[model samples]
Target: MTATGERNALDPEPIQSRLRALLDHHPDGPLPDAALRQIRTSIAPDHRSRPPSTGTLKERAQRHEAESAAARAELIESIHAVDPTPEGLLEFGRHVRRNVEPSGFASNMGAAEFAMAPGAIRAAAEHLLDTGTSLAEICIGLNLLSLAPRDGDSERIRIFIPLGRRIEGTAIKALGRIGRAGPHLAWAAERTPVYRRLGAVQAIWDLPEREFSELLYALPVKQSADLVQMFSALDSRPEGLQGDRRFARILRDAARPGALEAEPEALALAAQLWDEVRYGRCALLGFAPGEREMTTAGFQALLASPEASASVDAALAATPEDPDLVWLRMRLNRAAHSDPPLPRGLAVRVSVPRPSIATQARTHLLLDGVPLVEAHFQRGHSGRPETVLHDGRGLEALAEPRDVKIGDTGCVEECCGAFRAVISRRGGLVEWEVRDTVLKDPPTTRLTFDADQYDAEVVRAAADFDWEWPARRAARLLRERIGAESELMSRWECELAWTGSWSPDRSEMQYSFYYPKRPSGNDAYVQFSAARDVPYVPEVDDGAVMAVVDRIIADLRTTDPKSTARLSGGSREYAEALGFPWPP
Candidate 1:
């Protein structure tokens, strides 16, 4: 009021002069007493102070900031009195709220403070890992230590589990030092010693069946103790794995001979698993069906269909207790009434036809009426082109070998290759065929049968074309056989060492080196590494192992297929170390 010559309602000074100034400025008289009281209450306390600061608002703000900074400095010094270990920091963080509330001070802290002392943090983390405190708890402690926002616990775990090299500003960075030694270093640092020992075993969960066989030769006998412990921990098991035979096979592979003989729980699990696999596989592979347990009415109704009744009768005659019978019945019933997806169209188209007249002649392939690829022949020949059928769209197609005319010429004919389906780079399906001949290209034909026939054939082909399951089965069988027969010949332990990056097309190469435990032999124990294109995988029951085993036996059989003699020679025991009960 004094400086601007305006009325100030909250002012303690007399308002007569201000009221006169207001009257001069406005034709209306002074505000009413009720309105004046409200205006005084609405005015800010600082604005109505006895006298405003002689300095401007900016200068006063700077002075207040300086005073707040001094108070915050004192608060930080008190916080620093607390020890900086994980537990200490946790307690300090709790106390910070009381200090902040009383001082009316607020400040943001750097999240990196948690990682300031790597040694202390590492020690604390080691203690936590040993105690089985999960990564989630560790992250929460870290956030509190660093005074960072504590949110996204699940997101932090997801990011930490799959972290690779090149982690920066991430919780993983604070967990361990970024050494060039594989990205798994952090994972190892954060797990129990038992879990650390089984890191390679856990890889089985991610690897494809073909690579699973690598586990046979990879694990050392020294690690068996830890592996057995892990199996014992899993004895209670999950409900979903009630009839899962593959899991049983894994347990058996981990346990040494006579190891689980005393473990009744493990033994029971193994027996149940064996029954499930032996009979269930037979049912799934269409080898045969077993008996059914049904009410009288159900049995009579089943008898109404001669085929179903015959199937049931055959199952009854096959085994006294067919463990897979229940599962098979359920699956068959579901399949009979299932509504599955159909191929909307073919996946691939032929860029060009094979077997040009002047150029080398060959054939082209198509899937679902669409052309996929062309195969060029080394040399041209004359005859009617080979008969090719698109059949129809499906998950898979079987190649039927057929005698085909070489070209337009009738004089010569050759056995043509089979057709199969594959995915293209553009996420489309493509049909492929092996071109073993130098003759004319194979003919491409669309589905010729009626809609009903086409649908039936397509569904039938799809039904029998589950390659993934077969691969898993073969893996399991190989692991079981290998686990039963294979042993460390050398007394010393062997280590599984990875040689290169992971690749989908080829197996990862792993080599094992063991020093002779016997004093008499200076010979080195060297296990064969994977072939150039093969990857290492843990053994499981699957069809992928079947193909791998077939290849192994085929290569070995080149010399002697009938001989049950295992591959025994040199300081290293060859394929015989994992030979099956019967000749390949």
Candidate 2:
């Protein structure tokens, strides 16, 4: 104040007096006096500690990376203490999985930590393989290698551990033992762990000739589908799983009289399925082939397959009427334009109510969402419900409907005038006409039906004739071979008759067997019936049909010695004409 004449800014007495006056002016202010008194103490340099301003984003990221790197360094150092033995490797895998970042890419902490130290990883894997370590341990080692960042040939590592990890010496020896242990794979499947068992099964195609033959014989028919899947997974090139030599061997073994006699339908289906898969076709048969047809070279290769003859023989003996099998037979014979043009997206529906003592009933037939025909019938008290038709309203609507009978029961109902149906295509428009006045009722009943209807009828008849045999066989197979849970069941009634039939207007098969508890003579014999209004497929030789009859008769004989075998009443005369021994 004396030197510059400025107000005495450092004067404490004046400063205190000014503050007191200001505070007194605002005594009822927001803050209480006690709060004001403690403000200086609360905000003193010693007490004030708000965080300082953060650095730039790049700077902050750099700091985080450094810290993470240090932490990872510490983790790796700790993991290194674990020995590179099988047990140690498992522990390391656990550690890596636990620490792996969500993004899978972290400079400081990531699966790359394992890749950086391949020495330990490889050593542990080799040690596990050398030692007869458990499959789980080997899997853990392989998983670690798979997950590690790929610095080099990651595929090589995978090859070393194969999906089943069966490359180990012990595993290989065990697999060899399985091949020598006869055809039944159940034992091997049970003895080994899941992965090792699967590995052994996959090696079936590569087994020696004798071993392969044994395996096929021992392979359960129920497991045939599974075997096909495994075989399909193998190499499918011409020289691959379907090569001439191997396919021939498989066909010969499967077609052997013994194999066929044991599981006729299953073995045939398996062989056919194998061929289909080898040819790059779906395993399921009956459907039309896709757009891509095989080239001449591929066709020639199929022709040259050693098993071609055997497969044909089996088809004839097993399922001759199967459209797919019949077509396969013709194709193998180098027949021209043998493939049938099966309609796509065709669905068949049949509504048959549970039969009672009623005298009259009706059955409706639908094909691909369109009503084709209805069969109204009045069965004599003792006879089967006879199907009859009157006006051809539904038939005329079809592309080409033939054979219009008001009440035709396939058999000679009354030669007054049998019916005939004509189906044809004109300018891509299908026409079906049923003629009720066709004079020519052939001396023998020659029915014409579509391929689907024919195939469905055959299947239905086979299922119905001696039905108990299949049911028993399936139950036994499930119990003895597969060890499936199957308890004994009881029958409450005597089976009498079954309805196995089909209609030309629909591609559906109908089957139902009658069972009655009463000892009435009405339920005396097993009556099976089937109707056909379509022509039998030309691709299938008559021999196949004979084989099916023989099998049915054999089953009937086994099931009931005194009973007469009548498969599809319409076919009885045909069976007799062919010397099929069906009535026996």
Candidate 3:
């Protein structure tokens, strides 16, 4: 019962009765809309209201896992104690069918545990797998085979692989576990639907390169999204498909003229393939040169078809700003103009796009006026925008001889993806080599720039901030005025810092001298804000803000003698003074 004296929705008996009543009324067809609404309303509130436990989510999860472990141990012990007879095994299968829900938690015995089981028990499991009519018994048998994989059981498991969705995944897993299942797994990958072929593709990675290449070519292309997982699996292999002529031939065939028609799915796949080559996935760079040009030409041929082009244009007209569609349109425009291929020169330039409500100030890197990062990396999935160097020391940092993050997923929290490069100077040349990356199988990208040209470009980019927002201007002026080793810095124990405003229309220019080691709830820093309309020129507005900061800090010091002492003292004294009240 709930606190309101109403029946708890989680009470399975009542919920089951309600479901039975509904099913009886609509026995052979879909339920009416009203019936569906009734069903939802009956259970949604209680499910929402019930917290798993009166503890933090982490604590609750830990407790549940511990309980599950204890339960599994007890069940395993009980199974070990069961009599080792044909009758006993049959009774155990019956017990499982009666008590176990197909989707519910159950103890799965591992290889070592099954090895310790009586020989009679293992024989019974195989017998159940061979002839059991019950889905539960078959699923149990499949799991046992996978854990204690036997070469002899491979053929038996293969029979169940194509049976149905109910046990197909389990059967596939078991077959993959047995020795020498690569050929069978590859066959399955070719026959299964694209969505269900991930496991099969992963299992066949150890196959010979020729066989793997044949498998990839034989699989039918459906939607572009379907190929992402397949390409990902290929990229994850240690040796990769580098310099394999068979794989190169496969790519060449795929890129051949008139191979891909003007269908929407084909066009999307073309774009994905182009992206794959650009990002260097699947060891694409190991292939002969000019394959990229051939692929692009193939995609362009599809675009040249009047009917296909019209369809894509109509889609864009209806949903003009869909990122993927927009990206496709951009690529088409570039292709139509025959934009010069990625420049192989030493010159570097930075391009800044106008700011908008949805996007903040971003900078794009260009080599000889051709976009570098934009042409290479994928913009992350929807809602998470592509990351680029923003207004900061990001560009200047590139000049240093260290691995620097050139781009990333547009996340300020934990990074989901990043592209990094090592910049080094050797003699008269500056080398930019891809060191670590988020790409699956990125191509080798190493470029050498004349040392003088590279240094000049870095200096030019860092100094040229004509696109700075008012907040950026304010922060820059503050940092300049309050020198790195100023008395103000020592007193406040902070450095001048600012992250530009996210909003474009209304700039809340915030400048702060932040204390690096301030305690929680201790607002021990000085902050200033400027509005969008404020004068952005450093010479015009710098003096006024600096004056205000000086006055405020002077007032704070005079009023809080103890706080000043704590700030000046060493770590031990600061620790001793933590609990006492301090002036802001």
Candidate 4:
């Protein structure tokens, strides 16, 4: 049969198996030309024209909701009518198997449970858990038990935790909803196959703080990306590692001697913790008192050891731009620096303005108190004087002695063709070499700085957050408080877009919310304006901003819900990437 015909006639598994065999037979070299042509034809995209979609996204969504509601109603009626007889329940399970799509079946069961009495639902669910023969019946039982969780429901759910992916996934969800499932979830998180442990970790993520912290401390460090995500989630939480000496000890142990070489993820986690401390996102000794001193000493010790330094160098070579590795390199540089003579007259300074509700914190670089770009370039620049060096890390990059491009002319470099500067250090002097300017007579072709003075000023500027804007500070607080991976964010239909307007009086900060999952035309937004102002006052603004965020989250719980759960997870990265009206 032709490849297309075979694909149409047989199951995908057999076709995949055949393809795998074909590739394996020729593992030594490239496949024969005829075979390659055949493979290409088999997997080629179908270019056949088809009718365009008929309805708008809103219309389609409304239709789907109506259908789902009707189907759920029918499921409720069928399950409600089932005689308490075993045979009747078995037949009802068969009915569900025939009608409901597997993808939606579990949720349907849970939704239907809401329409019936808790006792009735629990009794039916328990029956299925205890004696149901089919997978469908048992899954339905698990879903129902999730909503009407009893003291022993978790035990019943635990039975199916190791069955397989589909069953275990449903089982995990059910256990997560049960308050008593902590022990079981922890057990599963540790004992389950590495690939399957993410579900277990997520299930236990919302456990009581004490239990969660204890479990986090006890959990063995693994090299799974899921564990990295778990670490990220932990770092984002305000209470994470705070006043937890035991957990801090666990982290310190992970960073000991060769631990980072064995598991690179430990390094990432360490860097995240260090970043939190450096940025003042968390308490200095919240994890363990004197952690900063311990960490610095450890890093210095690593630098002293040739073998450890080699391993770090190798990792840095592999991922040079990795923020964790970059931070490590910076630390190493700091440790190695000797007291050099202070440069005369030249200084590096930055002006970071308070972000208004409608604007972002614009950072401008200055040399000896003179604006670098604004003072030199007139045309092709935004009068706003916003430079690219917004984050402290950007300033760190600027401090490096290598030739670095700071920012281009405000317009597109390829089109308008304006001059760019290559900032580099030669001997004790730092020089900015200007190139590609349209003006024959530019203001100045070069600007110079003293290398020692430049490095000190940049480092000082990067560490100082005194000039930070209130809106940006509020965003950081929200990230720490709500957590980037919090289940609460998953409930929102719209992602929190970072672009917002500050009221003219700077009294309120408004944020734009976008529905990324929806179609282009249907991706509507709602404005979330908080009562706050520029120049953050910790005492007055923090509580007020949190209250506003709380209100927004509460509103999303009802208005947005699960139907619009997108992958953005309300992360700042996702929001910025969506191309909303971001402030400069």
Candidate 5:
């Protein structure tokens, strides 16, 4: 239609290159629809996407290898028929798998429906015996023979053997094709005692009728990599509301139920895909990739956290056998749980060693992810004990430890004292000019601790709150000190801390008082704080520790019954609570 009237030839650029170029753009962004569509196209082929002619010699070799698996299977079958020992068959299967797996893998064209008359396969197989020809040639006739059972109606046995009344259980297993045929394989899987754990895995998608394969297993395990990648991409689909959420959803979905526990071949696919899931190169399921992936792992690791093991334990949780997996989970969870960059300068407390070193720690994380303490801290111990590290290995390396000082005269004593926080972030340290000397840290005596053997230790942190005599002593010391200095008039700091399901908001606060201080070592200002951050209003007199204990009892009357109940045939004088409160 141009003025030149030559009827200019219309040329349309191929979409594949345009998509590849866009995907490879330097500032590569989350995939665009066009590129995603092209990728889908490249994966979904009619006859199996032929390898590009311009592909490298290596690529061509790979492609040829993939297509020639049937040839390998035939050669192996000849060897198998002659000697069917377990080791011999296994070796053949492994060798065949290694060579056959090299094919760039056709996308899972979806599972072959179970309806593919087994009788036809067996007949074609028998036909090969009579014809004295190649299995490849027999398969051609088989493919044609397969047509009747594959496409036509009325389903029936038609297994590998026509004359026999029942199908060979082994032949049935080899037919774990997609669609209706899957149940037959599932039944075989259930019967296979040696690999029965895999049966639970197969039952993961148990069919309603033991029939039609609507969501049949598509693509052989080796051939499913690209398909899984594509599905992972679909799951990672971004929201019009974009950001990290999209990436997160993708990985979460990729880690679905059957993924980690499928067939060896399929399990291998899941692990490979899990690696890509971790790298977070793409978005998933509206989450900012790498979201739930960390939480699941971290949660599992937390059960064996030193603090949980040593202190706040419900039941012992099992740790993963794989330490590297635990480490990966911890690092990722740490990042996923990172606080947003702060707008104000962050403040932290650090304590120096003295008689009983301790300081008031202050922090404003602005995110819920940060732990009040390193709750899962642990250290592994050496059976034969090492020379340097506390655990006889690396401190905090073998297992996490729930160890910290509260308000005790001696260090080990303080470790058992009822306190709010034990492990204070080292960065929060600061010194106030008291008089001639700097307060060693903990408000009262020098914090004595067993400095036996610890290097830059990574401990699982916890609080100690065992009450009775020591808790009584610490309360009396504070009351006697603060009551003497009522004139100082200080800041009112109240933070309701709880462990597990205690309702911090509704636990009736008895708001009590602290007495004035009498100058002990000449520090003018008196520190009027409980050994821990808690709702228990401490007594003004030495007789007062019981009042808070009484309040703990009163709340228990109606406090969610799930929180407290008599373990033994219990009486009035005894009770217990969950978790630790930090005592200064």
Candidate 6:
């Protein structure tokens, strides 16, 4: 019987008799066999020695509580041993597993241990960063090192790349489910130097030659030029270029001509770049008053130094001029215009007369005296608006972001372009895109379309567009041009520096900086899938490519009756129709 039961039984007796019997122990049992058995059980060695049944609610709960306390204590103690404190939990865990796991103790420690000491982990990271200490030494010293975890051999692998100025080889090695392109690369980008250099080069190498040319001028002149040479050696070959033609052209621009009559060739090179230009910034050379096009005057200034012999102007003006340069200049000028130049921020309204047929609608966005984004828009009718009543009849009460339409059709136009698209049940969406980067803004400029206003015919004069580069377009062209795998890798170096990240899902019909994430800074890679085929891009001057993209963008932006020719948004269809050789 329980102590309570015994007490209750005693209470049933008279107070005097119960007290006397409890004190004497003789009257309590009364010598009955059953009573004797109960007494014997209470005092028996076997029964006394047995553990408590623990079946009662309080006893069971107490047992569980004791066990839980023990578990918590173990976890806390374990955490204190390996990581006495913690700041970044996952990072701390990584450090501990990497440094401490080799010792015999850490493997034995439980999860609660990791949960206990947050400060210790932070200390470890600081120590790791500050002291060039070996993690293995720390683990062994802490008595945490031991054999690897059961499956750790399969799940984990070491990375050998160094960052900053100290690192040597940085080839990414594959492990488990992760490829050589490890996730650590993403994290390394923040703290490691190895990745930053690779990423910068990746951005530019992938773009077109003209943009790359402009990019060189924008890059830290010395450092940027060195990177460009490295890229040339790696990507393509040109005159005196060890790699290929694109890099050769870049090197040619970077060079200061030797003394004598090299003036004409230098001027020719300048003209080629000026005509084919695309995207790039020239903060390196300072600014220009007009749209910074290369001119004969500029050429004269460059070649007028004391070392130069013969009049640069006379050599260039010689009747038997370099036919190759002349042809290049002509081609670039033609590429610079659309049927009519695009207009920017110029909104006009016209309801679809049929309200169902889709026609090409166009617009231009201007920036820095140039049309930036231009394309055909799709237009359609919008539905009527309404409002929700307070009555909880139609809508659910728990839902968020309440939606209601009101019955009003205001003529107010939104900054959001709803008028660009005139949709129908039959045709699909048509959007504006940057086909060329050369046209002056406000869409249809008299200068952009007035072929008669030019001092010379298209074939004779170098295009008047700015020759500065745009890196993104260069990347597109490079990817299209080179067939070599290694060259392909280097193409993105410049582009990555400009755009920040890379994306493979580019639309053939559309062109823009189409990265997967809006980068804090660009990260271009030289690798591509084996199945992809990069088209052959030509070796036109960097300025000429820019001029072409610009002209094409501007020329496609108008709906005027004067439209004689236009480049299509789906450039492939246009190319097929025109049968013109694509710019490599």
How many residue pairs clash in each candidate at the backbone level? 41, 20, 1, 4, 72, 94
lDDT of each: 0.30, 0.35, 0.48, 0.48, 0.28, 0.28
Total backbone collisions, model 5: 72
**Measured by C-alpha RMSD in angstroms, how accurate is candidate 2?**
32.5
Q: List the residue pairs that clash in candidate 3.
A: 280-443
What TM-score would each prediction reach against the true structure? Answer: 0.20, 0.25, 0.45, 0.37, 0.20, 0.21
Q: Estimate, for each residue in 1-584, the C-alpha lDDT of model 3 and write its tens digit.
A: 34432233553333224434655675532233354345444433223544657789899889878876775665456456555465566566555445443322332456666435445456656645643444555666776666655556675565444333545567666665554565566544444433345455555665666765555566544321233325432323324444455454555566566666665445555555554444333323345666655655665555555655676677778876443344455444433555334544533332221222133333445565333444354532111111223333443334357665665545632446555556777878878775325456766578777777677666655666544544455545545555543665556454444423443332344443334433446433333222223332212345564554455456434543234333332233343454433333
Candidate 4 yields a Cα-based lDDT of 0.48
Judged by TM-score, which candidate is best?
Answer: 3
State in Å the error of residue 347, model 2.
11
lDDT by residue (tens digit), candidate 5, 96-169: 32332222111111124223345534343333222212212222222323333443211122122111111222
Tens digits of lDDT, candidate 2, 472-566:
22222222321121111013223323222222111222232222222355333233433222223423233443444344434433463223333
Candidate 4: which stretches are off by over 4 Å? Answer: 1-53, 83-86, 102-105, 108-139, 147-152, 155-173, 191-203, 210-229, 233-246, 249-289, 292-584
Once fitted onto the true fold, the runs of candidate 3 whose alpha carbons sit more than 4 angstroms away are 1-172, 175-201, 204-214, 221-229, 232-238, 303-307, 314-330, 345-388, 395-403, 407-428, 431-447, 451-584
lDDT of 1 at 71: 63
lDDT of 1 at 209: 48
Residue 311 miss distance in model 3 (angstroms): 3.5
Candidate 3 positional error at 147, Å: 9.2
Return the clash pairs for model 4, or none: 357-501, 357-502, 358-501, 358-502
